[model samples]
Target: MKILLYFEGQNIIGKSGIGRALSHQKRALASMGIDYTLDPKATDYDLLHINTYGPKSLQMVKRAKKLGKKVVFHAHSTEEDFRNSFIGSNQLAPLVKKWLVALYQEADHLITPTPYSKKLLRSYGLTQPISAISNGIDLKKYYPDEKKEAAFRKYFHLSETQKVVICVGLFFERKGILDFVEIAKKMPEYTFIWFGDVPMLSIPAAVRRVVKKDHPKNVIFPGYINGDLIEGAYSGADLFFFPSYEETEGIVVLEALASQQQVLLRDIPVYDGWLNDRMNCYMGNDNQEFEQLIRQLVEHQLPNLSMAGFKTAQEKSITQIGAELKAVYQEVLERPYDHQIYAKVTK
Candidate 1:
């Protein structure tokens, strides 16, 4: 069957979770032997699989329903994502809410990538049939590559013998860039790198100038990197640090683990089943704990592939997740909906 996939935006395709999600979507479509397009109006398509609770995809969901097509809306975050993003203001709030509520009522299927997000979506009036499908990692693309790994290390002027640590995120308040600054100050010997560029966002012109100058050197903000370059960076790094205040899913943690590197993931609901303290990573409550883990990984000499590293690779790859998503879409198309509420499903 044909399918049309809708995302809020695919800007520059940076090294963020959304970028990885889109990559999985593209690769999975190729493997499934199904004809697919990004076009919302492709007449041959049977289903429209849209990601997130964003306004753009919400509108796409409404249009797909009007055309008598099957609709699947995946929830990547809770209602807080809706009220805090670019649409938080009064002018766009009603329009964004109107479309999101429509997706909740009219879409034939719903999905959330993480358990934390499943609870979040339920709070947004999503009472229809829904399931949890955790995000994916590309095992083949992300494993340890000595050649590329060496090249990346030489390029960054870091020695292969010295352990390398990486932190990647768009420079937003929620990403905790300032937290990294604190972590870096305490542990100066370990190499720390930050990926993603903040100027990409459409913030007010006035604020842009101030944020541009704030990028410091020791933190190593190298803007955006895509394609083989990303995996190369992952291959060389000894560990990945992701301490987001709010994230529905942490795809990079899976990438790092798949590449045989450790992760210091934030202790949150989305990361519950995956990360274990002193196992896959040192689960952190705050900056002090993050630093302590860094010291442990540095001084203690943690063993490589000690705690079911291959098992993690087996569980969270693109091939595995794509198969699960295909099942969800098939179920949505083959079954009839018991409830379809056009009015506001919740107060």
Candidate 2:
């Protein structure tokens, strides 16, 4: 079937998680030999896979449904994930959730990145068929590179004695940026770097204050990075420290794992099914625990964690994700047009 994989506000979300997700989906679809189009005017398409929940996307969904075309919505944003994201996100969350329910309920099928996010959508009163799939990583682009790492270290003027710990995400409270800074303060010996940018006026006042404040000498915020430099950062960092409070699925975590770096994350419910403490990653609930874990990781007390993470990442490789997506698409096409029954069966 020809699928129209469309995302609205692509320019607005540039280099953001949603943008990366759209890019990954395109690559995955192409790798699976799926015929897809980004053009909304394409008449030959059998399905419309909407990735954004904007007004335009909503209008397209309505038109597609009226035309008897299959409509699949990608659940990238939930109220829970929206809170603490920007200046008015918390105040706007309830309305956003209500709007999402209205939009997603119109879909023939729904796909989210994690079971945790799927559960959140159900809680938001969405009755559409929902499935969880990882927004898989490109192994070749993210794997370890010793030469790149060396260059990265030299470029940053980092000494070999300093163990670099990295986190990548937008500068938002929900991403645990404050917690990350606090941890950096507690561990002065390790060099901490956060790779992300903030839309100047969009961030909350509290988050902006933190960004403007003088952080610990060891901490650095170099803004959003991409291409070879990003790969270099992933490879050069000794450990990946992501204490994000929530995520549908963290693509950067997968990239770090593919780079064969040991990951340390907050012990949140979103990672319940995939990540295990001391197995594929290290988990902590608070700053003290994070500090202890970092100490152990840097001291070589934790062994084989990086290799284990790499192995875990392989399960969500681009090839595997492509196959899963293809299966979901085929199943949705074959199913009868009964939303209630489809929702019940998928749940």
Candidate 3:
């Protein structure tokens, strides 16, 4: 069956994780030779795969239902991760959860990036069948690139011998930006670089203060980057340090693992199944532990787990994800659409 793959507000959230996930979906579909269209208004598709939960997305869901088509809602955002992000996000989180519940309940099937997220959605009391699929990684784009690595060092004026730790995320409290800065302050020998940005108007004051003024000399905010620069950062950095407190599934973590970089992460539930502490990656509960681990890693006292991490990445390749999506689509298409169930939930 033909599928309608749609992501609302591509121009606005195009650089966000949800946006990147949509791109990965498109690539996966293309690699599998699956027939799909990005147009939400297209009437020729049998199933609609939507990634965003905006008003336009709801409208599209209604249209798809009227056309007797199945809808697969991708749960990329949750109230837990929505809190502590942006200025009024905490205050708005409860309302956001209610909205998510209503929107998600309308779906024929739901897809989330990880099992952790699927559990979260179930707790929200959604009745739809949920599948946990990885956002997957493009190993070709993220693998060790020697030329790009050298250029990254030269562009940042970083010496080849100098130790560098890198993180890629928006300047959000939930992303552990403050903790990253605090760890950077504790280590003067290693340069810490954060490679993403959010509009200053949308950021919380505490995060804004640290990003704009309160950070240490060792810390650098190069802002949002992609293509060669981001790939280079993954390859060139001594460590890929991600201290995010919450996530559906961290695409950056996958990229880092695919690049064969040693990774350090916060001890969060989202990584429970795939990531093993001190195995494929290292996990810390607090800033102090993260600092200690960083020091140990730099001193080469810690074991190199990059190869093991790469193996994990290999399992989540685009081809595998494509196959999984095809199976899910076929299963959904084979099932009868339950109009009575939809009406009961909405009522």
Candidate 4:
């Protein structure tokens, strides 16, 4: 079947989950042995998968609907991001919400990365078929051996004996940067690393200077990092702490799992079916729980890990996840998706 994948924005090459999701979609399409094109005007395709409902994406979605084409929104984030970043906090949010509701009402299917996200969207009165197709992992890029602990230590001028923790995302409140700051203060023994861009958002010069000035010796904020470096960071790190309050699903957690690094996330319900305490993840509520979990992880007294459990979790390999996505596209195109899908292959 022919399909058109629409991205509302330009490439976010090496930063966030949208890039990861886009990569998965492309890989899934290729795995299906399907002839897919991007931004094609005159193509015969089975479906058109719009990535978002932004201004650009909305136009594409409307046109696809006009052509009587089946469509899916690989909606990986909350409508809040679009309402805030794309439309600003002005009258635009309400306007966009109306348009999105209309677009969603007209959509043949809505694809969500997490069940929690689906439940949340349902609260928004989006009464449509919602499928839980994750923005899955590429195990080849992430593995237990890929984390270069020694290299990371040397590059960051950190001691091999020192503990390392990583938090990947921009300096957004929803990403829980301040929560990380509090965690950094409590854990002076471990070297905390923030591997994401700060310049993307508008921060006051005074706040920037203050963040730099108050940065503890244990904390380091390296700007944007590429894949090799990111793999190395994940490989060498002892833990991944992402306390996001408003993420659809943090794909970074999957990357961390692939590296066999223990995950510590805020107690977000959508993470329930995926993360297991001490097994694939550690869930936290307040700073105390976060601190306690970190201490336990350091002590190695929680979800006991064997090579077997680690391997099983990491088995959500690139080919495996990509195949599932391809099947979702096929199923959505053929008819409305009602059955659960966690074990589908590309073929």
Candidate 5:
């Protein structure tokens, strides 16, 4: 069946996790030869697959339901992940949750990136069906590349002998940016790089303080980047250290794994089932633990789990994502359309 793969306000979401996830879904659909349209106004599609929680998406949901169309709402942003994200975000979190719950409750089906998120959404008292799907990775684009690695080092002016640790995310407190900076300070011998940025006005004052004035000399904030440089960062870096406090599912983790980079992640619920400590990757509970783990990795005390991480990335390949999405679409189409699902909002 044809689908309308829609993402509202994409211009505002540039290179963010939600935007990246939407791109992955498009590639997945293409690989499966599924007919789809990005146009929300397209009249030929059988289903509406919305990837954002904006006002436009909420309106589309209402309009689609009125037309007796199936709506698959992707639950990319939960209130928990929204807190500490921007200036005044924590204070606005309750309102965000209310809106999110109201919007998601109207969906015929909901898709989230992990079971942890599915559980979290259920806790919001949502009775709609929810499926956990990976924001799959493109292995071909992110695999090990020596030439790109060399270029990344040359461009950054990093010496070959210096141990490099990298994290990729927007300058959000929830992404553990403060912890990242602190950890970098603890390990002065290693060069720490954070490859993301947000407008200073939008960032919280606390995060802005650390990013602008308090960060140590060993830390480098290169702002946002992509293409060969980023791909090379994943491949060439000695460690992919992500201290994010929350995630529905981190797409960067998948990219790092696909690139065969050794990953170090904060022990968060989102990675509860798949990622194990010291198995496919390393895990740390806090900044101190993260520092200890980094030291162990540097000393060769920890074994190379890059190959194991690569195997995990393989499981979430675009082809697999496509097949799963197609199955979900088929299931959605075959199920009897219940007009009553629209009753809550219509009233």
Candidate 6:
């Protein structure tokens, strides 16, 4: 069956989690031998899978429904995840939640990154059928390489002996940027680098202040590094320090695992059943604990968690995710079309 996979406002999402997830999806679809198109107007496609809820996507959904095409909505954003994301995100979160609920209720099937996200969507009172799937990692793109590591270290002017702890995400409060800065302050000896974007005009004043003025001397905010350099950063860093307070699924964590870097993360509910504390990663509840864990990792008190994490990453590889997606599409297509049921449920 032909499928059209599309994300509205994709160009604007640049280097963000949503963009990365869409990129992974495209690769997965191609690997599975699935015939797919990015063009929404493509007539040959039997299914429309949308990954965003912008005005264009909403219009496409309505058009697809009218044409009797199977519709699948990929849940990449929720109200809870939007808070603290940008300048007005918190204020606009409730409205966004309402909009998402209305949009997702119209889908024939819904898919999210994790069970935690599924529960959150249900909490929003969406009764539509939902499935949890990983935003799987591309192992070939992200793996340990000494040559790349050396080049990265040389380019960044990082010394051979410096213990580099890195976090990759947009500079948002929900990502634990403040906590990361605090932890860096506590550990003056280690080099803390955050490789992500912080659009000066879009971020909140508080977050902007922190990114510009409040950070510790050792903390580095090299905003919006390219994909190849990011791979290099993952390979070169000693530990992937992600103190994010919230996430539907932390794709960077998986990338770090694929690169064989030890992970340190906040003990958040989103990682409930997936990341095991002290097994594949080190989890901390607060700043003090985070600092302690970092010290433990640096002083050789903790075992190498890279292998365990790598195994988990392997399990959630793009190839496996593609198979799951292909099966879901087949199951969806085999069933009878029921626009009446969709209309009733949406109403």
The candidate that wins on lDDT is 3
Worst 10-residue lDDT window, candidate 1: 338-347
Residue 346 of model 3 has an lDDT of 41
Instruction: Tell me the lDDT of candidate 6.
Output: 0.87
Q: Give lDDT tens digits, candidate 5, residues 1-347.
A: 88998899877785798889988899999999998998888878899999998899988888787777899999999999999998889899999999999889888899999999999999999997899999899999998999999989998999999899999999999899999998898799999999988888998788999988899999999888999999999999899999999999999999999999999999989998899988999998988899999988866788999999999999999999999999999999899977688675555
lDDT tens digits, residue span 160-236, model 2: 87799999999989999998898899888899999998786899877777777758888888888887777888988
Candidate 5, residue 38: the lDDT equals 89
lDDT of 1 by residue, 1-347 (tens): 78898776566433557756866876776766667888755767889887756566666766666666788776654444434333123356566656666666666777777777777667766777788787777778877787877777777887757766787766655666667766877776777787766543554333343346543445576667755666778767767788777777767667777777767777877677766666666678899988887777756566544246546766877777778888888888898643443222211
lDDT of 3 by residue, 204-311 (tens): 888999999999999999888899988999988999999999999999999999999999999999998999998899999999899999999877898999999999
For each candidate in turn, give its C-alpha RMSD to the true structure in angstroms.
3.8, 3.2, 1.3, 5.9, 1.2, 1.6
lDDT of the candidates, in the order given:
0.68, 0.86, 0.91, 0.70, 0.91, 0.87
Q: Which stretches of candidate 3 lie over 4 Å from their true place?
A: 341-347
Judged by lDDT relative to the true structure, which candidate is superior, 1 or 3? Answer: 3
Estimated TM-score for each candidate: 0.85, 0.95, 0.98, 0.84, 0.97, 0.96
Task: Give lDDT tens digits, candidate 6, residues 1-81.
Answer: 888998988668847888888888888899899989988888688888899999898888878877778888999999988
The 10 consecutive residues of candidate 3 with the worst lDDT sum are 338-347
Clashes of each: 0, 0, 0, 2, 0, 1
lDDT of 5: 0.91
Q: Could you tell me the lDDT of residue 53 within candidate 5? A: 89
Instruction: Give model 1's TM-score versus the native structure.
Output: 0.85
The segments of candidate 4 whose C-alpha lies over 4 angstroms from its true place after superposition are: 11-14, 40-42, 80-99, 198-212, 299-315, 335-347
Q: Give the Cα error of residue 17 in candidate 5, in Å.
A: 0.9
Q: Which pairs clash in model 1?
A: none
